[model samples]
Target: MADRVLVTGGTGKTGRLVADGLVWRGIDARSATRRPFSADQVRFDWADDTTHDAALDGVSSVYLVAPTDRIDHLAAMRPFLERAVARVPGRLVLLSASSLDRNGPMMGEVHGWLDAHTSRWTVLRPSWFMQNLTTQHLPSILEDGCIYSATADGRVPFIDAADIAAVAVAALCDLVPPSGDHVLTGPEAMSYDEVASAITEVIGRPVRHCRLTTRELAARYTAFGLPEDYATTLALMDETIATGAEDRTTGEVERMTGRPATTLASFLTGQRAVLGSAGF
Candidate 1:
């Protein structure tokens, strides 16, 4: 029998792409989700302990993706991770963020724990996801014809999630696991204004980037009914951007995938509809 790899956030952006890539390469991939599906999926919920065993059963590799929306994610993952490493002797490729090392607080906590606990591990510290322009917050831009944010004169090397997934798949499948962390990024770093301009060019529409104060941005999110903590977290992330943390790119993607990472313009052109759709 072929070795099975368990994808924790199988339905997520990077997870879905990684799972599909594995399947395309003829690997027997298993998807773990809260709800069951027709595909080779296991009913797994991060909040539920009972679902852990079945998800880890016969799995040689696991893609650890944390649910970013939850603040208690580290606490929730600790026990589950303890169970996994104890039961399965395999690679644990954790999907983390760039610059969020063991010293960066929340994400850093998870990064630190996994670094110490798992014998065979790979940390994917990717820059800002390009999908944020299409799947998540792009609609607000398209709907209002403006991208609103708290990032002030901050340039981020926005990376493609697909590129991150590709690197992850390589790490997950290699016979000899690569030691240490891989900082992934796109071809170049670009600012929000530049990114917005590129999207406007591709979609042939006028989309503007609106800069807001952190407090004002948090207030806007709060008005949208997001919890105070989440709103504050969003505000903090935007503030972090202003510090030039995401202003660098790395050669890790090209090294792992045997190809250079996609540029924001290329990503935007391919996802023109998503970037231009108000209902997306």
Candidate 2:
């Protein structure tokens, strides 16, 4: 049982990066995926209690990404987390969102539990990902040349998943860098409209921002096959944004990783080919 780190969402945006980062740092990184396709990956699913033991066995630390699409997921995750606390005996870094506070909502509740339960923990509350416009909203951008959101004119310091991973890797390595939740954000905040405009400039195509009501946005998420409650919660975050709730930025990324956070324009420029394919 060396100092190995178990990444729960090994195949996800940040999880893979965290795993790779750990490996690059000469750390033994174990990736936990539901379907194991590689020697480095162990089978793990939040719904399956049977898969928890093997995935957590002999691990020094865990980078937790809560079960997707399961709103109020603390109930399902507690059994495994309680086991992790006893079995792992190392850091437990959670990937929560910037909008969620300690004991506020889904992952927030998990945050509270970890604080009350253990001393070795760090909760990362990152702002919206810059990748969302390229992934989740890409279909609309390609088909209709538009980006959709309920946060009309709301600003967000959209962060790169890579930066989040960098911070997570640092947290796992340090074990106890800080005592409370770390709210990470990009260097600047901009609106979805600005995001669309940035894409337009990058791809030389007219991309518009389509504003929807919170209800409308929730419906759209459901259309994308998300559960109703989860979709509603996500859309409500947009409503929160509209009131300027997320109109701020923090230097957690740089402070943790010793690098400047990536900007939206730089990220979109890197994705120019993907974003411009349909336009051309």
CA lDDT, every prediction?
A: 0.82, 0.91
* TM-score, cand. 2: 0.97
Instruction: List model 2 lDDT by residue over 1-280, tens digit each.
Output: 2289999989999999999999998898999998999999999998899999999878999999998868776897899999998998778999999999998899999999999999888999999998888789889999999999999989999999999999999888983374578989988999989888999999999999999999999999999899899999999999999999999999888888989999888999999999998947
Per-residue lDDT for 1-280 in model 1, tens only? 2278899899898999989888877887899889977669999887899999988989988888987667656887887789878876778888888867764556677777877776677888998899988766766776777778788878888899999989888888873255578888888888788877887788888887899999999998889888888888778888888888788878989888888998888888789777766543
Instruction: Estimate TM-scores for all models.
Output: 0.94, 0.97
Best by TM-score: 2
Q: What is the lDDT of residue 97 in candidate 2?
A: 93
Model 1: per-residue Cα lDDT at residue 2: 28
Global CA lDDT of candidate 1, please? Answer: 0.82
Residue 92 lDDT (model 1): 83
Clashing residue pairs in candidate 2 (N, C-alpha, C atoms within 3 angstroms): none
| Lowest lDDT 10-residue stretch of candidate 2 | 172-181
